[model samples]
Target: MDQLLSTDMDLSSAETDQRIHDLSGQKQSGLAWVKANVKEINDWVDRDGFALLRGLNIVSTNQFSTILETIFGEQLSQYIYRSSPRTALRNNIYTTTEYHADQVILQHNENAYSNCWPMRMGFFCVVPAKTGGDTPLADSREVYKQLPEALRNRFEERGIMYVRNYGDIDLPWQEVFQTQSRDDVEAYCWKNDIQCEWFNDGRLQTRQFRPAVMTHPQTGEKVWFNQAHLFHCSAVDTEMPDSIGADYLPRNAYYGDGGEIAKQDIDVINQVYRDLTFSYPWQRNDILLLDNMLYTHGRQAYTGTRKVLVGMAKAAR
Candidate 1:
């Protein structure tokens, strides 16, 4: 941590609204500091699951993008096939999640249900809530080792199948795909090996199979890398409305061979995530970088306003 803060930069949290496009001049200090410790940050995140770099003077979403792009040495990845509602604040930055303060987002690896996902993700806290809003983290490696051998064997063999229903209850197809045209959505599905079914009633469904565990490209370690619990019907079965059919529940997971994953299995996954999770309260201008596969994250229900910007980086297939 001292190596990261070796350079002399403004340690105070100066919240400014002006967007920073150029990293030269006054912005160069932060960029240079990040450049100096780039390897350390990556090394730490690879050794552990994540690294929290506190005390940075980030002004706007553009500045957050600039610092993260510097560390990544490339442009940030767009949040495609998004499952949650997030308003884009800049070209590559968006609000973490627009869910109400009382809604607790379930723990899951970012985009783990999809074939392609960002290897790294950064979260910048612009505003901290008055009460409780913490991004809890869990080590997926431990999750993998602690799960039952029989259950792991089943998932390793069958993989995981994710089915998403779009229209009501869940996100609409247009929002999920970031397009209004059906043709565009179909083309994307075909390219990504996702099976899409369009109903005459204006609803859309997609099914894709992805592995439940993956070996980290950098660490050569296996991690429990799927979102079965978050996507299962058991996650929201109690709050579901009577009018909506159970089959139409927003998203669900099953065995790769088209068999249902029992609710008990989902319960077990959730319990393990809860037991392994750890969190810290947000301080404004704090930046968090996480290895998306090695760690899983979730939001806790809060009281007042909370604002956090997210950038996904280092795309991996």
Candidate 2:
């Protein structure tokens, strides 16, 4: 694991040479060397929002977890209040996402839709796809700068309200909340400011209003930080059947007051993401670290097996 095979997504290329650090060398020097450069590596990620670490021996999930904990100085935080399907390999490291091979997972700041989110995240590409299975990234600060002033103003004024229904087409209530007790679910929701309603048919509906933009505590920079585009009817309809009414959809986003956002607005937001998002082919054994608030990550559709593991920490409210 001494030499690095450059991938476009590595971000260690000429323009971003500082973003990649070579950790492969003598057998005994790798992890110790990383400890010495912690501040520098973190600085690179802080300045650029993400960085690629080359030549690491991250061959297993536990090894990945150890590296992440060693760098961040904390055990990986549990993926509580989960939104997507993922299998826990061990040590809180998880499969990034379990969506179908051909379905594209939209870019999102980890747990951004919730009141609490992981501030730091790390990803390891244990298995690269045959062709297109890159974990593309976007700088949220750039996203904020590129968005139209009017659109920003509207979102700022209204915030973002996410309405999620659980039962049939998506995750069940127990899985989303990670518990079976209704009382426990209510207690969790009460603590998180999420309004949860239970139906007789064993379904649950939840609504929460979160700010569309967030100020990074460390950077003092504002970022586009909500998942409105991913939850809008237009995007959901792309995968869901047209016959499914918007009301019955698994999730949807609206203005804070619950007013419908104009379709054109969602289109513009999605288009901006299209213009800004990018990825290089993933190479096996590549590790990527991100300042979650400063960046958003997405997955590409691929034909073969693609395995990426995640370790998230630095919880912030």
What is the lDDT for 245 in model 1? 70
lDDT of 1 by residue, 1-317 (tens): 00000111122232331111122334445556677778877776766667777665666788789889988879998888998898887768989978777778877889999989998999999999998778887789999998889888899899999999997676888988999999999999999999999888888999999999899998898999998887877776565635577667788889999999998887777777777876767888878888899888888888988998899989998
Clashing pairs in 2: 9-280
Give the poorly placed runs of model 1, Cα more than 4 Å off. 1-29, 239-242
TM-score of 2: 0.92
lDDT of 2 by residue, 147-233 (tens): 999999899889999999997687888888889899999999999999999888787889999999999998898999999887777
User: In candidate 2, what residue range of length 10 has the lowest lDDT sum?
Assistant: 1-10
Worst lDDT run of 10 residues, candidate 1, spans: 1-10
Q: Which is the leading candidate under TM-score?
A: 2
